[model samples]
Target: MVPKVPIDLPGTRYHKARVAADALRQQLTQIIEERRIALRNGRASAEQDLLSFLLSNGSDEEERGLTDDEIKDNIILLLYAGHDTSSSTLTSLFKFLAENPHCYDQVLREQLKVASSKEEGELLEWKDLQRMKYTWRVVQETLRLLPPAQGGFRKAIKDFTYSGFTIPKGWKAYWTVNATHFNSKYFINPKKFDPSRFEGAGPAPYTFVPFGGGLRICPGNEFARVEILVFLHNVLKNFRWNLVDPDEKIIIDPMPLPLKGLPIKLIPHSK
Candidate 1:
């Protein structure tokens, strides 16, 4: 979508985006106020979480703390950047695994090994996470096939030439992850969901960037990885789920999502 086009005029998609942003800011403002009150009354532990740390400036009085509005803005930024990407990836991962029973079995086996190593009611730790090699490959392949971020925009720092085309300096450029992900030069039978491709050295640098590449790569990449892996480990250990719509098509409304929302039926694992 040509979002940069001067289409913010009423009734346009740009206008709609602006309206949605305003609504979100208002909601975050209210939440920030509630958090501030909780911190003052000891209702919520200060430095307990990101919001608290932001408010307290890492418990340092000398360091300047973020203003209430700044804290709210950051909360909005993190939610906007991190929330949907991880959720969509998780949904797609499960959907694909359910459709490919072999992959699901492999994932389940790997997770079982980790689960058995831990005592009953024991939580996953860093060591257990390190053992999730196959599951991580599945995550990698899922990201390759269905990247949560489709493309990103970057302003050209200098004029450049590629494929016999010259791009002028300061011109904005868009890089599509799908093009690289599916390129034959970088992958063999790119459409195939073979997590084995991730076993060795993996794809060339900058070629397999689901979180992006280089200096501007996402800062939350590690956080997202830990969150997804931990969630997957627990979910697989405790429950089995099946996609209600095996053939549900993914549609990208800016980001990829199932056409009808990825509905699933979950059954708790029997002892």
Candidate 2:
């Protein structure tokens, strides 16, 4: 989803937003300072009552800056994403590599072509990432097949019609993404994790949005992609991993989460 278009803010809306922003700046500054002090002095400064002022009204504007509650909320939301969402994607990748051992060889081949034997070359960077076209393709395919948000709920404020069904105002709509992915009308074999499905495949104009569609889509979709690619490429390169879990137990039915929270063990790989 792109940045929302500018709209006239109601008086209440603007006031509430400003209020939230101010509070966030103070909260973030407190946390950052608390961590810094803890690092240097081995504890937080009890002389400062940061949390107390936070509940009331705290503004350290000239020094630290205005509170961006929007930014603060986003940062907290990202914690769950960075951990839970990533864990799900990695678990899927490990499961695939475990079942199909040959995929590891394929990944290794791709890495060898992209890196130098030098120590510095092994360290990944944003620019270095461009070389791994195959890795990107596979991750894209994986996300398409098993999006972290398998589905979502949306409520209609006004009446709307989708397909033959009419959703009146004040009704909840549950949008299904995983169902869309399995449509054979699009993919020849929708169930398979074949990276070739996306090879040179420019996005077709339609609603296959795994992240979501319309307002309130996940903001960290691209960030998650980069994170997964870097994590997968490095981990798979440095160590070999195997899944001791069986396929039938994977339970892909409930959201993007694995049924059993996949348990895999990794062993170091020799170059």
Best-fitting candidate, scored by TM-score = 1
* Global lDDT scores for all candidate models: 0.85, 0.67
- Candidate 1 RMSD computed on C-alpha atoms after optimal superposition onto the true structure: 3.4
Q: Weakest 10 consecutive residues, lDDT, candidate 2?
A: 50-59
Q: Please provide, for model 2 over 1-271, each residue's C-alpha lDDT reduced to its tens digit, 9 standing for 90 to 100.
A: 5754545466766566667766866877687566545734745443455332332243333245335453355455565556677777777777776776666678777876665642765577777677778777776676777776677788899998889999999988878876667888777688887877767754464446767776777777768777887888777768877666666365554446666677777888773
TM-scores of all models?
0.85, 0.67
lDDT of 1 by residue, 1-271 (tens): 5565566788988898889878988997777678767988999776689887676563233456676667777887788788999998998898888888888888999999999998988888888888999999999999999999988888889999999989999998889898889998998999988899898898888899888888889999888888899999888878778888888888888778799899998888893
| Model 1: residue 127 alpha-carbon error in angstroms | 1.2
The root-mean-square deviation over C-alpha atoms between each candidate and the true structure, in angstroms, is 3.4, 10.3
Q: State residue 29's C-alpha deviation in candidate 1, in Å.
A: 4.1
| Local error of candidate 2 at residue 158 (angstroms) | 3.3
Residue 44, model 2: Cα distance from true site in angstroms: 12
